[model samples]
Target: MSLQEINFDGLVGPSHNYAGLSLGNIASASHKGDTSYPKAAALQGVAKMRGNLERLGVQGFLLPLPRPNHRLAERLAYDGTEAPALRAAPWSASSMWTANAATVSPAPDTKDGKCHLTPANLVTMLHRAQEWPDTKRMLEVVFGDRDHFAVHDIVPPTFGDEGAANHMRFCEGHGSAGVEVFVYGRPGGKFPARQHEQSSRLVARQHGLDPEKCVFIEQNPVAIDAGAFHNDVVSVANERVLFTHAEAFADQQGAYNAILAAFPDLEVVEVPSDAVSLEEAIRTYLFNAQLVTLPDGTMALIVPEECRESASVWAYCERMMAGNGPIKHVIPVDVRQSMANGGGPACLRLRVVCDPATVDPRFMLDEAKADLLEKTIAEHYPEQIDPDDLWTESLEKHVVAARQALLTALGIGELA
Candidate 1:
């Protein structure tokens, strides 16, 4: 069998109604910053997300971060970063460190697990963050790393500016024609100055997208830096844009409603204030990066299910499918630690263009191997093959099988 492409149209977002996969974070020891109750709880949350992804046959790659380093600390401090006084402000270094730390690590070539100074190796690993073993051969031999795909990149205007440009340069990544909400800069944290906004606009123009397509919104006044929550302006798929209605900070509802008004064509669903904690809400608003559209015109959000007690997973699934028919599904990943540290499922998973013909067989094979590998890896390398790692490997195998299956199924090759 050969590979096949799985349509991404319906694979994004969460649902209150249907079942789907989730991703999880590693234990606390794996995270950066001081070990505190908040950090511990976040790690447990990441565990849940990992369990969910494994159950759904999704794959995740793990990126490890070292203990607090002066280099990174100095960079963060010099960047004019601000910490919100709010307990829920999601931009705290501790939380952001948790997220960023997961994405950095000891070099693969380094046996001591020490950070590597080579920029090339660093980029290679970052690319690997989105690589799957099943698709490795095809990607390496046919497409190479230079030709890949990404749905979107939720980047910090400063640090990620060049990264985002590089993504577009190599992948030709573009924005969808749908509505987008831009949350203007917040109070305390560093906001992108007019120059930054202009730079962003220039990038959009380079991609051939209209700058007017973006709608800017304001953040809560009491909250530090409005730019911290800028990512929340648009939903995952670019189907709908969210923004603040009034300039006054702390008006969550008004801001949300304003976003709704901007896109009358979209079915605006209000996320209940009590559904998730302020911390969870802030994380959701900041970290979500994956955007996938379903076949039914509804959207699926692959985000961190912060309040496990309420099952944020099930609720999102339900909301997307409500009245729109049964074509929707929600995939809640456990990145409790990631989210607590200001990252989400979207942040952890980097999107790349996939050839459908090369993916179908792999998907099926992945399903078959998931349980087997899960048991085997868990039994042998319990500490290493965390639930997320197991799923990632299984999914890689599935992609390989999918490619072979597609070829065989189409009679393009002889069955072994």
Candidate 2:
């Protein structure tokens, strides 16, 4: 069946205290290290994007891979005679900036269930410098289901002018439906980077799509520093595109007004600054909040709201609505550490697949599960547990504890 919606899986960067590579630093290294909070937040914002996809039967998993480490080898003489220099094996570690995890089966069928590495086709810091040969090797080793895999060649140590052109050719060779490219023009300008513009146009031409279909939206150039276009901007359900502009960036009114002028027919909603802070706006806009469509065709946007001096909170509401009524608050998930290094919940989870048959609008989690999970987690653990802290380690422990309690409560197992 054809997909009604496509949600990009996200990865959280390492935490500041975690003693690993920082995602913000990795993404901004090429630009002389002017870290964009919005970009960093967008990378971290993946944590906040869970419920909408979960409700749709779309499962998100963290990508599990180490960061690549590169060091040059010193030339050594063999048997006291100077000869040809020997090469040292490449060095690398699992990526901390890129959170990675996968589904697996306990059985030994070897094909029943296994983890697969889906390549991020976009450009990334590692690929930009061409420093991740080990990453590519590791991916080839684990992914058994190669047919289902596709690469996102937009980021990093791998992307360049030639890489972009090659990506276009690869997509065309495979006859992909089309490519999704986000265009962020220079502030107060109509065009994006010349290289990006040229590459995108070439790809569109190859796909036989009208150059006009290559959706372009105006975004603050400074915001681009934060990896703004890494997530969804165009809706997978109705193709409704969402864009945001903040007064801190530039002529806020004029930039937004100009964008509105360009796409007069598209639905454009000015997000309330009061409801969401500048940092939150930057992250949410870049991460691309989960857009779920109701049976009646009305859409709901689930976004991560940065609560007053606290961790991140999720806000579920209709984007078209003026007032905040009908808004429901999901339990705040503390991602302070991840956010510090530039990522959130949504960035940590990758949506592998969605069940189309279960898209019923009425479907939702039982309210009782919330209370049960909370109580089970609290009573079993004697240590202090803050409701606001939602780090992965804490959450995983709580979830396991809650499941055991739930099983016991259901008379299905003994809670030991």
Candidate 3:
């Protein structure tokens, strides 16, 4: 089996809007009540996927989950919730950020020889809390082969589990056995720390990971309060490289010590606070990049175009690449729409390390499929979605029709 990492990016749903549901996310909060461009947002996501497909040989995508979650709407209506935000929550297309979809343990990391995936409970936010049932159904359909994969239901929602956004793994190569790192946070901060220590440990055990190879660490509450809601916003790991910000962990040095104790050859490419402040890092989503290793073995940091717009960020990137570093290329992709909603290249994707042949072909991406997705979005998706546009009968029909069109085009049966 040619074990490699395939980034399955979420196809942005038609209900994409800015109701500002996610707390501790500065971008999402600031953009509340703003009219969102759904077509452009989804297209930007598709374009990013296309870029990845062209850059790497393989790319996969998860479809727009069924939206305007009617059951949720009915329950909210019955509750007679007066809060506009709560009323609008049912229409959230936040699943477009697949990093929260699940936590995956590749074959090499587990005791059994099959890959294990646990859908995140995401119990922290009401909007996201509703995703696991549908998310699990979709996951089982795509990764259904029992011989090569084991897709488990979410760990009990008692504690929040935000999936891969809070998980990282370090290994000598893509196919090698790796040390898994689960980052959690303590409660009591101004903003809720989403990943609980108990939850991370539960997920680690649920995946049947070798206890000796697993390391659970704490996230810096300082960073969380400052809008680094998920660990991905401040750090990302690929193969042997750990690219991160200076203030990414509660005890930065201790976190390094923990990982190093497991994986001795860990090459950390740390960015100091002097060069880029945490606020600036969060704004540009510098750490929330797709740090991928190319076919030729050259590593590339796929960043949001906003990173290039930040003079300081791009300058630092140029300087880093100029040196003989592990990450040779800095590729910028346009995902501005997702960025404005508190997600970036990293947030939009879920990394599953496995053989592509083991995955359902319908879920994979190619040039022709990219064109088909583009055509579908252009023809069916609404141009814009205002907050008020959410409740109307006309818009509901349009959103439903658009998603049905996508499912038909992709040959994916309705998400049950």
Against the true structure, what is each candidate's TM-score? 0.42, 0.46, 0.98
As a TM-score, model 1 comes out at 0.42
RMSD of 2: 12.9
Candidate 2 TM-score, C-alpha based: 0.46
* Runs in model 2 lying further than 4 Å from the true structure: 4-53, 60-62, 67-181, 185-209, 222-238, 241-243, 246-265, 272-280, 283-288, 294-298, 308-332, 349-416
> What Cα-based lDDT does every candidate model obtain?
0.30, 0.32, 0.92
Superposed Cα RMSD, model 1: 14.1
- Rate residue 242 of model 3 by lDDT: 96
lDDT of 3 at 330: 96
Q: Which regions in candidate 1 have their CA more than 4 angstroms from the true location? A: 1-199, 212-264, 272-280, 283-305, 310-333, 336-342, 352-416
- Candidate 2 has its poorest 10 consecutive residues by lDDT at 165-174
Better of 1 and 2 by lDDT: 2
Residue 273 lDDT in candidate 2: 52
